[model samples]
Structure formats: C-alpha cells, structure tokens
Target: MKLFRSKQANSLTELVKACQKQDHQAQVQLYERYKGRLMGICLRYARTEAEAEDIFQEGILKIFDRIGDLKKPESVDSWVKTVMIRYAIDYYNQVTKGQKQLISTDYIETEWESDDYQNLFSKLHTEVLLETINELPEGYRMVINLYFVDGYSHAEIAQLLGISEGTSRSQLLRGRNLLIKKLDLKGVKQHEKF
Candidate 1:
C-alpha cells in the first residue's frame, strides 16, 4: 500500500522524514508550508500580531524538536495545528495568570438562536467578523474561539483552559452576548424569526 500518491503528499512525507533526521532545509520547508495557517490560529488566541508571531515561532521550534515523535506523517497538518494551539493557550494562560479574576462568575443570559445568528453571521465579511471577535476581552475571546471557531465542546474547553465546565459555559455565554452587542452596534441586523 502506498502512503503517498499526490505530489503534495509526497512532498509532505519527504519533508517529515527529513525533519525527523534533523535536516535543516526540511525543517524550513515544513515551517514555510504551515506558517500561514498556524499564524491564523495564533492570531485568534493572541491579543496582538507580535504575540501571534512569537507563538508561531515557538510552535515551529517545538514542531522541529518533536517531529520524530509523530507516528503518522499523513496527519502532520493536524499535529502542527495542535502544537500551535497548545502553544497559544500556554501563552494566553501565562500572560493572564495574574488576571484570573477576569473570568466572570456571573453568566449573562441572552436570546441567542443559533439559526438566527447563522443567518446574521453569513452576511458579514470574514474580516469584519474576526475584528469583532478580536475586540472581545481575553477570556471571552479564548472561550469563543475554542468553542465556536475551533469546535471544542465546553468540557474540552474547560480542560484545555484549566477551568470548570460551568465557567467555560459562562464565558461562552458572555462572549456570545458581547459579540451580538458589537455586531448590533456595527449595524448588523438580526434576522427576525417568523
């Protein structure tokens, strides 16, 4: 059975193999191939572009250090993504360690119909939506990104963030409310349910 058929897969397999053997050129190739996508994940977690760059660099270094541990070369993209996200989460936790009180215990209730919001969200440009998400407070942004964007469940988010599930739920709720408010302020009208 062949592991790689496409040129892209062959390239990826070769790159991973070379990286495992400590080939510097292969390391560079791997970084170049995935940097944009990894940087986008970093940006979702980072408050600033500089912070995202730092996370990206750190993740790349970790990837090079652990490239040999990867059992499946075909899953390199997801492995790289996981490494980058873990790095970003660690960075976020370190930066906000002293501000733990910011995770609000009080959950705010908002009338959020997913179907309605889906319709509303479909109308906004990607950049506009991202900007609105970025404007959220750090904790809120993290929960929102992990839950909504990254497709992690509340329990998964709680574990990743070292918080209780209830806290994760609260943060997600508040984050959604805040996003809706910001979108409304930006003149994004909610679709009226018939």
Candidate 2:
C-alpha cells in the first residue's frame, strides 16, 4: 500500500507494514493517529504538561524503534497503548528509585467497586477528576493509574512497580481515600465517607 500524499493508509496492515519498513510518511501518519490517545496516557501518569510531553516523545520513539517487532498489525492500537504504559511504568520506576514515599496505612472500610462510589466519582467533571488524581502523591498516583484507569490487577501492579501485592493494595486504598477527601474538599461531596 503506497502512502500517497493525497490519501490515508487504507488499513492497519498497510500502515504497520510501511512503518516496519521505516517509511517516513507512514511513521508520521502513525504518530498523528495515536498522538491524542497516547498523550492522554502519558498525561495521566505525569504530574505536569512538560513531563507528559517528555513521556509522549519517549513512547513515540519506542513505538517507532520497535514497530517491526509488532507481529500482528490488527492489534496495533492496543500494542501501542501497551508500549506507552510500559514506558510510563519504567519512567515511574526510575524517578522513584531509592526514594520511598512514606504512605499512611489507614484502612478505610470502603467497597471501591460498589455502585455508590462509582456514581459519586462519576459526578465530577472529567478535567476536575483527572486533575485531582494527578495531584495525589507519587506512589498513590502511580498505583491508582495502574489499577483504576489501566485495569491492572493488584498482583500485576505489584510485579510492574516492583512492590509487594500488599503494598499495591494499600497504595490503591490510600490513593482512593485521598482522592475522595480531595473531592470532598472541592465540594463535590458533602458527607461521604469511604
């Protein structure tokens, strides 16, 4: 499939093939296609726009550098996201190395999966919710993103972040509590306890 200037790549198979061959235009097209989505993942992990841009650039490079390793073009969207998520975790690990953020072990009795909390959380504007979660402490933010947003299991999160499963659970709990409290402070919730 020729990446002609007048038209778009017609299929994922074609795009992946051209990208694997280092076709510049195809690479640009790939970049353009996933920029918003991949950058959203980066921004969710990063504390600032500058940091998100840095992560986004790094992820794109990885995507380009390893595009040939992608065996199935049909899964390109998910594969690209996986690449970005792994890179984000690596970035997190590097930043947090040897700097253990102290975490409070308060065990809040809350069914995080219950519909009540989900409805409560859903009430906030998307921007407000993301900003609130972003402002959480590093450990809290990382675990929350991994578990809540990315659908990673606690065990998977533990392996990814190089922490114990218990630590993952605690971090997620703490993060959730902190996020709820922050939401409360913002007048999103008046008498909610979790």
Candidate 3:
C-alpha cells in the first residue's frame, strides 16, 4: 500500500523526525516557527519577560527532550501549548505553595463594579491590559493573569493556587475592578470598541 502524505504533514513529520534525532538546526527552526505564539503563552503565565523567556526555554527543552513521545506529528503545536501551560502551573505552584493564604471573605465579597470590562477587552490592546495586570499585587496579579490572560478557568486557577474556586473567581473579579479603577484614574480611554 502506498502511503499518501499531504505537504504540511510531510513537512511536520520530517521536522519531528529531525527533532527526535537531536538535529540542532531542525530544533532551531521549530523554535523559530512557534516562538512568538509560545512566548505569548509564556507571557500570560509569567510575571516578567525574563521569567517568560525562562519558561519558554524550559518548555522548548522539554519538548525536544520528549519529542520521541509525541505520537502524532501534526499535533506538535497543541502539544507544545499543553506543555507550556503545565510548566506555567508548575512554576506557580512551586512559587506559591506556602504562601497561599485565606483572604477575608469580606474583601472577596466586595461588590466589583467593572462589568464594563467584560465588553471592553477588544477595545484595549492586550499589551496595555497586560501592563495593567502587572501593576497588581503579586497574589492578585498571578490569579488574574492565569484566569484572564491564560484562559484558565476558575477551577483550574483554584487548583493551581491551592485556593477555592470561589476565591479564584473573587480574586479575578476584584482584579478587574481594581484594573478598571486604575485605568479610569489614569484617564486611559480605549482606542477601539468591542
């Protein structure tokens, strides 16, 4: 039986083969192809560019080391994404293990007044939003970054932070309210509208 290979699949298979064989040049090419998307993922999970770069390096290294374990060549991008997320969560879990504190329910229950953000994300550049998020206190920043920027659900953030989903949701809501206050106080207006 003649096996048919689509052009993209053939290329991916070749890349995977090279990766499995420890071809440095092929690995570089693969990294170049996905670095931006991967770095964006890293940025969402990380607090700083340096930290994101560190995670990016670690994630790619893991990908290269485990290339042999990837059963399907076409799923490499998704695989990388999953690895990045897991690595991010691992980093967070390690950093926050003993620092997990129960914030007051009164603070968590503070009625947030940022429903406008729900409709305003597309209006603001993600970079601006990220900058605003970076301005948050460490705990609030991490929770919000994972929840809003990384697209992790509350349950996932709760699990990652060793907090309840209620805490995760409250943190996110409070973070959003705080962000809106910061933006408003800074007189920053959205350049575009969602």
Instruction: Give the candidate number with the greatest lDDT.
Output: 2
Tens-place lDDT digits, model 3, residues 1-194: 01122348678779878988889999998888777887887776677888888888888788788888988887776777777778876876776445755453323333445775554554667677667666665567777777765567888888877789997887787776676666553434655232
Tell me the spans in candidate 1 whose CA falls farther than 4 Å from its real position. Answer: 1-7, 100-108, 112-119, 187-194
Poorest 10 consecutive residues of model 3 by lDDT?
102-111
Sliding window of 10 residues with minimal summed lDDT for model 1: 185-194
How far is each candidate from the true structure, as Cα RMSD in Å?
Answer: 5.0, 5.8, 6.2
Summed over model 3, clashes come to: 0
Better of 2 and 3 by TM-score: 2
Query: What is residue 108's positional error in candidate 2, in angstroms?
Result: 4.8
Tens digit of per-residue lDDT, candidate 1, span 25-128: 88888778877777888888887788888988888898888889998887787788777788788888888645745544334566767686666666666666
Give the candidates in order of lDDT, highest first.
2, 1, 3
Backbone N/Cα/C clashes per model: 0, 0, 0
Full-model lDDT for every candidate: 0.78, 0.81, 0.71
- 25, model 3: CA deviation in Å? 2.3
**Per-residue lDDT for 142 in model 1?**
91
Cand. 3 Cα-lDDT: 0.71
- Candidate 3: give its CA RMSD in angstroms: 6.2
